[model samples]
Target: MATPQPRRWIPYPPLISVCASLWWLSAAAASVHEFPTDGTVIELDDASFERAISAFDLILVDFYAPWCGHCKRLAPELDKAAQVLAQLNDPITIAKINADKYTKHAAKYEIDGYPTMKLFMHGVPMEYTGPRNAELLVRFLKKFVAPDISFLESDSAVQNFIDMAGANFPVFIGFGLNESVILELAHEYKKKAWFSVAKDFSEEIMVAYDFDKVPALVSLHPKYNEQSVFYGPFEGEFLEDFIRQNQLPLTVPINSETLKLVKDDERKIVLTIVEDELDENSLKLVRILRSAATANRDLIFGYVGVKQWGEFVDAFDISKRSKLPKLLVWDGKEEYHIVVGSEYLDDNDQGSQISRFLEEYREGKTIKREMDGPSLIGFINSLISIRTVYLIVFIVAVLMVIQNFSQTEENPQFRGIQDGAEGTDASTSHIESCRDYQPVNKED
Candidate 1:
């Protein structure tokens, strides 16, 4: 038998190619459109900037000069960040305005820099002081975007979801609820934690967790065998507090699955390096670290045991000559610091040293260092991966389909099809309900 050959690529006709390119270019334009636009970044000009700002609850606008090298460098990162945000169906919009070309508009926004960034919340603009990278940008934008929440309706589905995510993510399950508020919550903290709503109460899991009331919140971390149950009053503010309290464990094993949780929302990681199972002293430090972490939700607490995570220990540059247990803080950027001596952790009163360590860190006393590679670049690379080819193919296929069904004199009978497409586009702009949501029975 002969080996199969790859399919040959064919070019579109000149007319159709030009039409598709123009259509896509218009769709990619920054100006607000009646129809939903595809792609990562929206290119805004003076005409579209104001409407685009007011249209979204939160919008991140990049004011960039065409000739500036810095602006050119940031463009790709901004594009990648927009792609990530678009995937989540997040309300946050990433848009760019050509400051050099639109001097009047740039002056209006007071963009004095080549690549200045401003975040608009409810149409009010504020300067963005965060890092200029994809991960940080994504993390920063998500802060403004509403949380993405998941709703699970049945007993088996709820249990299975909990069991599945329990090992990786800390599962926050709200029981005996069918309100839109929970869905709203899922979007609010969607970046920080995983949330689920179980409309029908599960008798077995409820008894297992020992919850007495309806509309209660339960957090279960199957990895550590820890469960926290909250009796409601599940109001928005109250539930937000409940979620922050139980979103993460005090000390979790740092692995591929949990690495994301440890690094989510651009928080600094306070990792305690141990042998395998934590000993008495390590456990005491974990308790103190948990207390510190509870107060400082900005920090993620985790542990890397040597026996299980030998590579992790070496990744931190810890040698065999070093002590068995150690503590370190990594900001995922490039700043990494270690607790000077094991005695520093064990010498002081129960929590005093760690407190001072955090204080010193805030005081800018911690020694800055670098990792083998930056995670942000790794993430940006992932975002700008081979998906671009697929995206172009998809766009081309869509354009060809539309062109094939064009309403020429030969296809006069299909005139309604073109009109219906236009009507759908007009109506789609207004239909803002949760399209991802499904009926409870649909899950089963």
Candidate 2:
């Protein structure tokens, strides 16, 4: 009984060491998976979301869900965009967050759908509604990353750019002056056109266009061999007006070109039906329309020389006996005289007549006939044209209509598919739960 038992120590099991090693390896793999290995796109999460977004001048974020089919399809487009954008002079950062895993980030940006792409510029976020193609993405990203204005001081720089540009885009060159304001236009129309500033003009450049001043704008369409010259006080609103006016044709003729212009334009077309193509009065009408056009870019100014095209005059119902230069407007659906009666056509106050016409149109005083507005079929076609937004609206509207029809008098208070959604109290618990993560403004 007194025999002391030899002290025994249980040998440590091998499984303990093996289990610890597996746990360590798992953690290492998780850390690696948390970040994107490729440099094209950055992986963001709740912790680094704000800082990462704020670091870039312009960053496009893809709020995606793993199980979403649309999200999976958009992944390749986003990766392609990221790679292409990576090569820009000033690159735009393309990043993504797994909204399904990071529900907080999804809630922050109000992500109700998968693959929601937003362009955040200097902390201000704008939803991207453009096409989801590589070409459109490149063009769209260039809007945020492009230089405001490129200066071409030497003839070689100007010539090289113009010649090498392949005449695919319109080239706007400001000669003999370097105004900072042009940069504003450059930013606005960067995606639509190319802009450059030249402090001095070469003899060849000046000889091509008839401009004598320093602040002259030359709109060159190399493909069409067309050039529009504008000389002006190029510093303020006037400069902006000049740029806007030159961006489109001053007066579009009514024919094949007119059909394309009208079909493409969603705005009301202010058309002057002239009996003569080169008539002085017809030209005056065009000039007046141009003056009006300079202010209201929403309205397109065009002239139909109906003398040769009598069928068009009948189609628009323009009276030949009324006046040589009769003014009427087409809503891209039906044509109506600018003035209800023909008296205003020859009025000495031509500007006032046009102004009155526009004012009446804007104030809803101008009556829109069944023909003046889109027909039922045309309206349906137009609805389809705005597919993404209007399609959703149309579906919702149809559902509401069906739901209303399905409801009976017995349950008059029935609230269809939306049921308690509308006018229901939204819980503030989410806000309360997220309060800790919210950034507090120091001033508050």
Error of 2 at 39 (Å): 4.1
Q: Compared to the true structure, candidate 2 yields what TM-score?
A: 0.48
Per-residue alpha-carbon lDDT of candidate 2 for residues 41-159, written as tens digits (9 for 90 to 100): 89888887887666666788898878778788888888888877877777777889988788897787777666778988877887775557776677656756546667887878888
lDDT of each: 0.69, 0.68
Instruction: Give me the runs in candidate 2 sitting further than 4 Å from their true place.
Output: 1-39, 43-48, 63-74, 97-116, 127-132, 159-171, 180-194, 207-214, 220-227, 247-298, 301-366, 369-444
Collision count for each candidate, in order? 8, 0
TM-scores of the models, in the order given:
0.41, 0.48
* Residue 413, model 2, lDDT: 62
Q: Model 1 lDDT vs. the true structure?
A: 0.69
- lDDT by residue (tens digit), candidate 1, 60-116: 889887777878999999888776776766556788888778777787876655677
